[model samples]
Target: MDELSVKASSLGDNLSAPDGSDLPEPRRDFHDEQYLSQCSLKSRDLLLLTCPNLGLQVCWFLLMSSGTPYLESLDISKSITSLVWLTGPIFGAFAQPIFGILSDESRHPWGKRKPFILCGASCVATCFLALACAEDITDGPTNAPTADSDSTKHWYTQVFAIACVGVITFAMQAYQSGVRALIVDNCPPQQQAAASAWSMRWNVAGNLVLSTVGFLDAKRTFFRPEGNAKFKILAVVTTACIVVTVGLVSYYVADSSQNPRGKSRQPLTKLCWSMLCPAELSKHWNQLPPVSHRVCTIQLFAWVAWFPVLYYTSTFAYETVLPYNFARELHEKGQLDIRLIEHAELHRSSSMLYFAFATFATSLLLHMIEHAMPAFDHTQPRIWFFSQCSLGFCLLLTFFARTGATATIIISVMGASWAVAMWIPFALISAEISQPSPSKLGGKTGWILGLHNMAMSLPQIVSAILCAVILGALRWLNIGDGIAWIFRLASIAVFYSAYLINKL
Candidate 1:
């Protein structure tokens, strides 16, 4: 028998032994049968698990709400602004997998995952503080945007932003991989679906709260007076909230022992090197279960199709469709004095609110279906592919949508599908990778999760660089509707992705 099975068997033997001998019947603990029954969390545990996710969702929304505007204020051209915005995902993509591997290999008295979580939270908080302080350091006598703008430019602001994203990404990967492993370790196989459901529910709850916050922040009152100062205050407050919530959850949630006394094995590194080497890549390549390889390939393609559309959608709606529609309406009504920026902000806020509601409603519907039927077992890869295709198609429709209301509805539908696409494939990949095993349990778990993150991150980097190039090229061509090219390219990618998913 392998290590875990042997250890479990030994424990069973010790517990059931007729002992008047070496081991007397261990005094029955308070958790006899009743506690065990109660421990298997039903729907309630899922809801509680989502608390940490809520904090994360808020941080994400806040970042998305302000990031582009903040970049624009830096006096950078629109094209370069898009490129600079890519710094977060590029750094985060590299950082997350390494952290995941480290979490897998770590051995500490407190636990392997908790240390990373605390470190990540601390880093994110520090970054937000620095970002908040940027204007204070740069403000000058005339208060005309500074002469030493390049020198006075808060390099630290960008540094902190990248750092905060890196740490958060690291912490997220570690906590998710470790906690999901912990669930598999502690609970029976039958209960895993419930755990997955709970995790998704928490994600939706967090998204809902963040979306609401974004909507409120878009109001004139919030952005009009002392705009920079107000945003900094909000950032600091939200960062603290995330750190505290994640910290508490990590602390209280029990971690399964990394190596049971008699069951401990060689370190993960030694095993990984011995089993998976360049020389042996072909020999052992086929050893991995076919299902896992298929899922990973499908995931990579789906992300490539999805992320460009998502990252650019808000900007497109605000800059292109909204301005055109508002300007046309004003011209028709003979009121030519409407401010473009103010109108754009309103449209942006409205779109965010609508997207939020649609996402929450869809999540609720999916949850109810899972609760009632409990076996909504569609193939995840197929579902994820179709969702991404749908998003691309919807985005393409925006190019031709004549009415503002129709465009808004199309964008909202795309947003909702994108939200579902993000998590479902991840959930499936996590389930597939964490399947019961004898050898290299920790290493396999970490590698699978790390690869999954890499898939998500790499696509963002490509999208950022490619989109900037496309936009720049289209602008050079004087194609007034340059943004439409982006949506069309995304549709083509999605169709390619659909083919890849079908092959898988």
Candidate 2:
């Protein structure tokens, strides 16, 4: 919930003062006395603030699990649906920074980030609703005006589905930016690592929701379970979660911007300049505490592995299952049907469920390990190095997987590192910025976090490009199976990232 930000009492116009007189903790006692008294947060408070992430995560998983298939159901070609997945990376690269800047500068009396979050969440919810009712909305509950009605309705639904996905992609970027900013803005510096762990915990919960929903038979519902009924149920659950979690933090958390005056927009020229050549941000980049830079670099490489693996996991599961189930032979013999695909996808859902539990268990186990073996944690400084080594091994292992269960187990073991990847970087960055700085970092929380998000997204683009080039070269040369090379290359990248972790 509130884990995205630390304490307003701990934070302000400037996170620290020069001459080392002020660090993340201390403030002008006399001036901040009343504010700190009112705004100081407990562990429970941080939990409340971060709760919104749960709903946001559900929205994310829904898209990953259902977006393309939903479009396919509308009679859209598989090729077009595959391309639709690109919208997230493309929009994420641009949207996070823009929204971060806007949210940081917001002077809304209600709060700085909540207003943007509200707008974005509303739009996302609306899009989900539209997707859930695409057919009914495009045509009547029963429409058969002419012989051409089926084609006309399918066309309408196709366009409607695609449009909704586009809106959801952009809106989610804005919403996520705001929520992340809200978290960084509110939590105390001391709890960042815990916050990161909590973020992963919530992510696991979202995965559970996806797995549970996916496990349900489409025919399980009482009325019209064939078409969009499941999506409708998911939409209702997602909307309710947003209202409850977001509404809680919005109503309970104190306003972040102490400044009562309205935050005004910058001139277009200045805004563009800030985006293109932010001199101030560049200075901060250079001055970041040692660990922050190393973590950022490592994160970049880690995502090189993650980008392909995450995007391809469902396909990987399908393919892996097909070989074991004899579906591959059937396909080779030109026998394809809905049942065969469904059988394969059933295993995909099982893989996701297995991975979710692994991640959740790992997230919890890490904390216990830290407490039980303080000296071990000291060796890697937050077990980051350990995570990298395991992560690299897991990625490398993917290339040798020959069964659906084997692939699933590999993904599950990856939880050991995935837990760290989710929270450690954000926690590290937040801590670094909060420490005394060589440059102006005050009120730049959003931009700094935005840069981190950009780092993650940029890798997706690179990995996508590299995948294309590698695949193309393989086909051109008529080489042996090149798909395995993807994992090998990803493993190499991860090991290098692990090397960087040692530097950290």
Candidate 3:
């Protein structure tokens, strides 16, 4: 038997023979409960879960995809755009952990997660609409051009937009953590990876379609000639879909009462403190099985490596590589006025299209690997180590990238590593951490997910601050010269993550 199997067997033995206790009545197997739940779920119910997640994924892609364009339309400098991108993760980082804890303790009739999902989607839609309105007003001929003019209006618009994003981000965190808990609550341990993989398929499909739509909308001006109208329309449409899908899904997949509500489960100050205390940390930490801990650590490192790349890669492409290549080519032909927007859009479309294709291919490959190696028991830490190493290697190749095609090739490889980084660790976590007994069905699943979100959020915060500083410093030192070093730093982080994952 492999290490995981041996450890699981040992756990089962320990649970079976509690120290100094009289023999108790045998309980139903956890796997049996999960099997029954899966059997009970109709095709329609499954569709409900899948559809909402797709909607959520689409919205996520839309926001990130449109962010740069929206900033450009506001007449913010490229330096400011980079800073705003970094700021997103700062707000998102704090929001996710707090929201996770809130969702865990929440007890509304709409269910713990559904309320947050609705709230989050609404907030995001509202914010996008507000931005659209701002864009329309700012770009109007009525507005006076001045040094302070752009800064003042941009600041207000950004404040509102950022606040809305923060709210939606918190909501998304609650929804994701809650949904994962729901899956663990309802699905058997053995099928967790399969279920997660299936869920991720929907996520990928949504990303492909959404990114395509955003790309087309940006390129063709589908919404209107008026600034940011497309963003508004897309936001409204996406939010409506999320609300309807989540509402229907929640209605069909009623919460199981297998885990009883305790009066002490109320979200109280004392209880919060008790949970946060270091002594309780050990108790809660001990509750996770060894495999679960390893998987979580692996996930932590994977996100640390991956999110920085995702957050900054597009910026790097547009600001650093694309400009330099296009400028050099144009300089040869004596063409000087290379509009940033035109160049940015061209590179954005190419890069996103490449990323979409890479993700689809990687997903298919992983699916096949899972099917072919059905009985393999590789741990997440090992997978994480190798993936991080791969990412680091690809990123380092950027130093040697001298042409657009070479840059695209490097970015595509980076995208593939990103694809595995996003999905694989979560799948491993689902497989490793789930309880095998119905009695401990809940099994601190919320806390585990909360910790996972925390890990993701912390690095996001760091990246935002660090990237801003690095980009700002680079701008001061002459912009063109500093871009490569930023990428090099990202590569270093990936290598460091590989090291950390190996230790885990």
Quote model 3's TM-score: 0.78
Cα lDDT of candidate 1 equals: 0.56
What is the overall TM-score of model 2 with all chains considered together?
0.84
Candidate 1 segments whose C-alpha is farther than 4 A from its true place: 1-39, 76-80, 137-188, 260-289, 322-338, 378-382, 438-443, 502-504
Better of 1 and 2 by lDDT: 2
| Residue range 179-229, candidate 3, lDDT tens digits | 665554444455566656667766777668766776676477576575567
For model 3, where is the 10-residue window of minimal lDDT?
1-10
Stretches of candidate 3 above 4 Å error? 1-47, 75-94, 135-158, 217-224, 257-263, 271-287, 324-335, 339-344, 376-383, 436-442, 479-483, 500-504
Candidate 2 Cα deviation (angstroms), residue 120: 1.2
Candidate with better lDDT, 2 vs 3: 2
lDDT of each: 0.56, 0.69, 0.59
- By lDDT: ranked, best first: 2, 3, 1
lDDT of 1 by residue, 1-504 (tens): 121221122122223222223234443231233322222333333444445655555555666666566655544456655655565566445555555556555566655555665666565556556655655644434556554664555554454444554454444444454544443333323344555555555656665665565567666456446757656766776676667667665654544235433344456665455333645433333344465556556655556656665565566667564554456567799887646665666666677677777777766766676666645545555656667677768867866765446656877887678566645665665455434452333334544555555566677788777777787787677664555567777777677767776675
| Candidate 1 residue pairs in backbone clash | 54-206
